[model samples]
Target chain A: MTEEARRSPERAKRLPRAVREKQILDAAVQVFSRHGYHSASMDEVSEVAGVSKPMIYSYLGAKEDLFIHCIRREANRLLAAVEAGIKPDLAPDMQLWHGLRSFYAFVAEYRESWTVLHRQAMSVGGPFADEVNAMRERAIELVAALVVSAGARRGLAEQAESSGEGMAAALVGAAESLADWWLDHSDVPDGVLASWLMNLVWLGFNDLVEGAVWKPAE
Target chain B: MTEEARRSPERAKRLPRAVREKQILDAAVQVFSRHGYHSASMDEVSEVAGVSKPMIYSYLGAKEDLFIHCIRREANRLLAAVEAGIKPDLAPDMQLWHGLRSFYAFVAEYRESWTVLHRQAMSVGGPFADEVNAMRERAIELVAALVVSAGARRGLAEQAESSGEGMAAALVGAAESLADWWLDHSDVPDGVLASWLMNLVWLGFNDLVEGAVWKPAE
Candidate 1:
């Protein structure tokens, strides 16, 4: 083994308990991604984290609570990544493009985070699904706001905002869904994937606002 | 009870085995949707179908094979529904618009079918994911062809097939993902969901072909 790997105990004791909790949660996401929520057990998570089950329970709550915490933490991390990527000096379309790239980049680097957010969260019943859905709605609303203001600034009216919500839903869904698809298929970079959303949504929304409709042309 | 309930033995004998098999398969899908694939048992399926367990085994294979059968059957039914709804006489854009509407309508009415095709299929490992993804790719390929040809017809000379394929992945993912979102909040009609997609994608794709890009506008 390498020098760092050969001295395992020296590394394990270096971090505070909070840092250790983060370590455990990171391992938990990986396990959850593989087996899903129902099949993933506390025992496996503890084993993967190189910590005892008691130590895990002491830091995070029981299984469901721990999962919720994971979702909350990861969702914020993802959103923050997107938010940080955008620059206010850029135009609305450019801002959206930057955000899309950020999302794809985040998911690409953190595949397990996307998996936990997408696949595992849905299988869960009751409050967990509701929780994830709420977070999703928040994301949609954020995107919808971006679309509305941008459209308005370009002379598109207030009425566009009503339909903007639904449009945002589709745009967000396409981005998240395509991100998952890109995971399985290689050769598509995060920038290109993000660019697809930009060219498709931003450009198209621009066209409709400018009144260049896609008609029968008969 | 209905007259059919009173004439159970008489009706059972008269019904063909092919008809009976279909009834059994439908019942299996319902049961599978409520509980996941692994959690669902043959006994539950038989009980739901009002048939014996042996009959189910005889008609379908073991649990895994039976699930795969359900995926294939449901996938075919869904694809056919979409195909039936598209009219070639309409403009290419309009053809796509109708197809999206039809897709949402199918999901709304045959929610169980969409659920089976989407959620349940992905839950199982290996073969089921591979098969469903292939079927999904075929659907995307059709959309990709539409996008690529539309781009070419406008003298753009851009081969959007590959990128369209990626967008298709995003679009399908969005449709399926939004459908899941819609299930919790049913106030949004199938038509609204479909049109949301039409606006988001159709409008965006239209812009690219026209070369009216959504830039900073400096």
Candidate 2:
């Protein structure tokens, strides 16, 4: 056998199942992001991953299952990155600022992941859309908790509790929509995007908590 | 011939093509909203519209074409409602407030249309998703114009021009997202939902134009 052929088995043996699955998933995400779910192929994923088709199928099942895995993995990674970026010790606005910054940073660094998670998965629809929705619900809950806590600190816990989730849903949607917009307008850096959102959302949220409402000038 | 059958031709003649198409479209929207695109049947649409299947085919084409027509018609109606609600004589904030109130009112009045336009079309993906995106682009442009004008009135045209479209994208997204959230939390009145969004976004936007900014605590 050739030298590379002889080393292949050894490499496979050294890499555990989890490592191989990650390799397959990484390749799958790249391919899916580039071509989307309908047009993406298993062959490209295998070639990019340097794993055989059978091996990928064994690790992650077929293309549908593989796409799901990529979505779930990327969604978790995004949430984790934002969560890690938040400093609970800081004030609510500061915590949100950091979270937004981390979110944009993650999107900027992993454009492919964001593309697959936000664009590809959403357009593919069906169960894929469901997965993205579930992830969004989690993100909303996280923001709602922050809004409620901030309200409690201001002695407006009842008002905050009543409107916090809806407000969080709007904020999450704004962040998501801005990120999707950034996919086309990449010239704007991540920090600026995050800052723009902060100026657009946090200031208003601050006013709401501070009992300053904007009424129509009828 | 039976008395009813004798007058059928006269009735068909009296009802113009446009009216017939509207009847067919209304039924199609209801069916699509209830059963979704794939699971929905033309038979149900015909039954609901009181129009024969062959007549529907002649007027609106097959299931796919009929669905597209439904989406386009509803999108136009929605845009028209919001546009009509805005009074150019009013200030920008009041204009937007009126526009949002009109939007929620439309959603409340035609929950089925909103369901088909927002949830069903999006989940069906492909061309349907493209149609929704096009509608969204038009909305963003409308909001961007409002932002740019508001900025110009404040002598901050340059700042607004640079970020008007992006900010509008975020605002439009927040509105859409909140509407979706309102779908589940229907206890909140249409006025309350619109006011919540105004408090969540308009105040922040107002602050931005007035030269207020939120910065990191650090």
Candidate 3:
């Protein structure tokens, strides 16, 4: 092939928009995951993707825009993982078991995505933190919905919802917190951590379903 | 008496070491809490304390030294608040309750102090994070002790101890995450958040005492 033919503009015309966007986001997540949002540079992202800076700008708009896209993409993946794994037809306990196990597996499979979504994004100073926080709230609400459904099966939904929103918050908070602890204790399988949470909160929540409430000693 | 004569050398003399140290720490907490550790300035801290830069240097060593001192001071204050509120005489549920309540209260009263210890110190990246993380670990272990106490009382101490460490880490993480959530929802009293935690985890924990574990559905 001639040198002129080898240097054709066909290279630029070859890649589809969707494929290029993914390439940019993958590189952006890699860099942002390492140094956090404030410290990550557009220059490094382009170099890592082997694309020019202008290509990144045209495809992803700007740094913050790129970050939100990453967050939205990662959040959808995580939320969907939990959703797909939940077995709605089963008993509440079984459903929660599936959901918790799915969450642990997702974290184990996608450590960088979770880190970028949870730690790195939340620490920054702007709309991205809000975006991350909203996703977190959605996760908590998912737990709350599960708790409410479980409680409703036994006529206990009102209490769990009224008082259970807070319970949902605490339960989800504990799960997220335990997931982080599980990271350092990688010696322990994520399945065990998921089961531990199931035994801790989910079991206790079910007990509350049967007219059981822990009251202070008289 | 002449004003100049009354003032004399006594007025120009340096403050006692103990007093100077406290003043510097108070000022450092204020500055660190306001601007975060990186943006905080020694000059501002000295000025806030009504001392000179030289005195700050002689007393606190360097910026990192001053930050560690601030974290140590504030962490101790928070730990003491938690420890003082806990009673080994109580059941594990109540013991955990009191500890959570005390923690929330400390975060509420010493808002800046806790923020400096939890947020800013962790961000600056060094021994400061380690120092703060150690104090936080102690707080978690303390909660683990309460959980273990119940298991011990039930003659399941061995079982509890084996898993109590992870539970402690999860419990602490839950409390830390909720404490952060409560910061934005200040209208909710500390007792409320503490009680919510008690209902969520402590109540469930009490069930663990009774041999009720939530198992996966068949």
User: Which candidate number maximizes DockQ?
Assistant: 2
* Top-scoring candidate (lDDT): 2
Q: Per-residue lDDT of A1-218 in model 1, one digit per residue for the tens?
A: 56775776635466798888898899889888899888899999998898878878888978988888788788889989988987877877888888888898999899898888876775553455556667778888888888788778877757567667777777787887788678777588887887777777776776666766554334
Better of 1 and 2 by lDDT: 2
Q: Estimate, for each residue in B1-218, the C-alpha lDDT of model 1 and write its tens digit.
A: 56776877534455678877897889989988888777898988988887777777887877888888888888888888888887877766887887787888888988887777776776554577666777877787777777777777787645475676787787776776677667656787888777666666778877667876544444
The digit string of per-residue lDDT tens for model 3 on A3-116 reads 665886435356888988888888998999988888899999998887778888988889989999999889889999998999889987788789989998998888888888
Model 2, residue A75: distance off in Å is: 0.7
Q: Candidate 3, residues B112-180: lDDT per residue as tens digits?
A: 997887667655545676787689678777877777888999988997987787787777877877777
Candidate 2: misplaced stretches above 4 Å? A1-4, A7-14, B1-14
Mind sharing the TM-score for model 1? 0.77
- TM-scores, in order shown? 0.77, 0.96, 0.79
Rank order (by DockQ, best first):
2, 1, 3
* Candidate 2: clashing pairs of residues: none
The interface root mean square deviation of candidate 1 comes to 3.8
As for lDDT, the candidate ahead, 1 or 3, is 3
TM-score of chain A of each: 0.87, 0.96, 0.90
